[model samples]
Target: MPTREEVIEALEAARKKLLTEDAKKEFKGWNRTIQYYFTDSDEYWHFKVEDGIPGELINTEAEDAEIQFKMKEDTLIGLIDGSINGMRAFTMGKIKVKASLKDISKLQKLV
Candidate 1:
């Protein structure tokens, strides 16, 4: 398992990647908040997107989160590093997402 800091770093990297592509328009244009909960770290990482732009990771409380994801640190790193596919992780029961199918698909495309 990675430390909490590693997880936060990975999430930050993902945010940068997401913001650079058309995927950002598709994913964050919804102007919603997404929260990631790591079971191993017992920490919540939040991304607040506004008009197709993603802001900094919110280490504090997530306000009005529209999507939530639960996973362990290893799986998150693998997914973020492109070593593991998000769909495969979900199907293999390594990751669990709580969100609408439309929103999930947008994020999956980004990853």
Candidate 2:
């Protein structure tokens, strides 16, 4: 399993790839937050995306996020690297999300 810094780095790379392709526009006007709980380390990393930038890292006390995803760190790394499909993993119960179906659907496109 990768460390928290490694995971953040991977996510940043993914975000850059998405942005370079002009994919960030897909999230325009969308303000959502997601918390990733890495089971191995039992660490929680929060990601908040609003207006533009790749969102910010937040502490545990952050308010209710619009979306939250929980899964093993390795699985998350796979998802970011395109080895795992986010939607499929979620449907297969490997990834758990707490959010509206509508928002979840939109997130699928982004991932």
- Model number with the top lDDT: 1
TM-score of 1: 0.87
> Considering summed lDDT, which 10 consecutive residues are worst modelled in model 2?
14-23
Q: Which lDDT tens digits does candidate 1 get at residues 24-89?
A: 656654687888888887888898888878888987558678888889988888987889888888
lDDT (10s digit) by residue, model 2, range 46-86: 76777644565654634787777778877888888889987
Task: Score each candidate by Cα lDDT.
Answer: 0.80, 0.71
Clashing pairs in 2: none
